[model samples]
Target: MMAAVATAALLSGCSVGVPDPAAPSNPPISSGPGTPTITPGHDAGAVAARDMPFSAGATLAHGVPVGLSEDLAKAPQWKQVVSNAGGASRYQKSDGCQVAAEVRQNQWPLVAADDRASTAALFAYLDPTVLPAYLKPASLRWGGERGKPGPAVDVLVLERAAKPTGQKAGRATVVLARVFGTAGSSVYVSASCPTAAALAAARADIAQWLTVVPPG
Candidate 1:
């Protein structure tokens, strides 16, 4: 399970910001698997300023990363914590679950000269040489789904080994989906949970939110 989690972290390196030199230093407290550490002083204003090309208004989906429905937003269990100028948004659930969504101008051209270069970079990151021993038993699957322009989604699941204490093993799952539209617009969403039940609920919420196209 840790192997799958590590692989997903590498694939979804989503943090975007310049560290604030003056910000206080604080260590991250692990809430559970897949929770991101919160940095005290990161300047995300410039990134947020980049047009999201989507609406941040309310939606019907509960605990979604996109425009959260009013009822859910107002509910005691979920809260919106981050809204960056880079068109990135995040929501948190009381149970330590999280949902985040973002739309950015595809920087592939600037990152590399062409698709080949981009693919090379991606392959290098996912090189099998670095995968952990536990990954041998993990399952990975990917497919394309229809969206305004279509998005590619990947699902990974790994069953953990029993503890030395002989307790039952747990499971972890990650779902990474992204869409790249014409004119440089790209939308990406990721949801993860430590258990099958939590992952299922998270995936359902994400699916419902993804259906609402953000206004350009």
Candidate 2:
């Protein structure tokens, strides 16, 4: 239906970057229950990917968490969207911070047999030249903890910066995406915030899902 389709188009808040500037007070779109996906695991401290029954916003057994309404204090809970690639969910906290997540299939390899290349790719995010223009004033780094999400190549991009004194309404821009999937697929989860304080506020809830076991 038109109503259903209209709601599906909203963006998930997957990152440490700015997602939107105008909507400083609203969270991303969220809805729908989901099933978890399995990835390569069993010996790498990550359990084998498995499918489990999850409600509209439950923590995934192996994939990124979605549809988490209980975390938010009031109405307008997590909104979810599903498709062939995978699914995504978004939610906004009453305090103006928002979190979002997504899992999608890919044609190219994401978790390669030898993660050397993939590891390099994750490290590339730390390259100063590759970062966004706005991030020039900000400092970015990857999470120190490794051996997560099973045998998949993964990285949790982190950033810190002072509240912008120049940008208007604190344009949302930083999104530190982590892909947790198999060789060719990925799940992008992010906490998009307008300021450093906002991002810190949302970090605890967002990390609960993003830092879970399995690739995506």
Candidate 3:
């Protein structure tokens, strides 16, 4: 029992800001079979400013693609976090990032770019209710930043699992956070089963993904 608990604690990683800054990489292994697969895809199309229907402005992160807004529509499994007040846009991760895309919508603004570190921490520390118990998160990876000064961009991912609890309890959920700077848009994706042999697995992908996106 103690070994299991220790293994879970070691699974979580912390890779914010500095991208893949040689952070902790390896995720805890399950008693089950092999590692999960990640499939990549192109952005769907542009996320029209007018269509936002919620906030006013939306900034693009430094990296990432152009048509991500629309691509999210493709990810049907992604579930938006429910909130009463109208402030930020929201999206959820479905099928993990590889094959699955983001889905859902809301009118919330993205957090500031410099706040990337905080964003990662927030996902890492998400309330158990919002996320599944088995979905253990280790670190947060960059998505994109808005504006020149750098507002919170789109997409932030967590590395490994802390323990096991959510739908993916006993498994790792790569927490993904997406923010729309202008239309107050935001989305969170809990990518599951991150498997890297080294202590730096999460950091490598997190940094690479952040570089792929552009500001909204």
Candidate 4:
């Protein structure tokens, strides 16, 4: 169920992931609890600490499980750097299940001066026409199909760090072209729920996920 949502979000648009502009700059968000300091650097201890243990949701159309977690302490040095640099918060189930995950605070610097305006800019920047056949559909519907989404989730883009310079991989680009970690900083938020009311319930967490430190 959750995997479907995540995959669909990806298929519909670029799912958030490690900054990859050349790749699709989109991956799923994590559902956990924690308020920790997030900066951009490396921390091996944090990687090991982030061994998230939780349950797994159904696989998506592409056959991928959703809801994963890891101990931030055990994360690799570079993983920690990207996570904090992106201002992330991992999540997991209290149970012994191993479907852990993390929803890093949003951090894409190249957001347009106006939040709403930036959303469109990102869509255009990651133009599906420019992507390969496989990515076209998702990039075209990056947020959602014709603006319609499943009852549980809403497809919207939010502004984060100020835009950067150059079309360099992680330096800067148009919109979605430069992902948060890789370069231009700005991203879309995919919030999913099982029901309309439940979707509303998830807003608080979604808001938290959007909070990112202003880019310098």
The top-ranked prediction according to TM-score is 2
What global local distance difference test value does model 4 have? 0.27
* Models sorted by lDDT, best on top: 1, 2, 3, 4
Q: What is the C-alpha lDDT profile of model 2 across 1-216, one tens digit per residue?
A: 111111122242222221222344565555765433543342322222332211101122333321211222223433333222335556666665555544443312233432223322432432423333222111111222323432222333434343368654532323444333232333344555666776675665454333323333
Of the two candidates 2 and 4, the one with more favorable TM-score, higher being better, is 2
- What 10-residue stretch in candidate 4 is worst by lDDT? 52-61
- Residue lDDT tens for model 3, 1-216: 222321222233222112222324564668987533221332222332212211312333223222223223233443444322222223334333221223223222224433343333344443322333333323222233422222223344434543534554444434455444332234443333333332134333433333223323
From the highest TM-score down, the ranking of the candidates is: 2, 1, 3, 4
Taking all chains together, each candidate's TM-score versus the true structure is 0.41, 0.44, 0.31, 0.28
Model 3 alpha-carbon drift over 4 Å, by segment:
1-100, 110-159, 162-169, 194-216
lDDT of 3 at 137: 29
Q: Cα miss at 126, model 3 (Å)?
A: 7.0
Candidate 4 stretches with Cα past 4 Å from truth are 1-7, 10-115, 124-183, 208-210
Give the distance in Å from residue 92's predicted Cα in candidate 4 to where it truly belongs: 6.9
Model 4 lDDT tens row, 1-216 = 113323233234433433324445565566887434333463323322232111100011111111212232242221222232232332221221111122322323234233223333344444433222112111211111222431121123321221234433221101111122222333333433333343333333333222222222
Best candidate, lDDT: 1
Clashes of each: 4, 27, 63, 56
Q: Candidate 2: lDDT over CA atoms?
A: 0.35
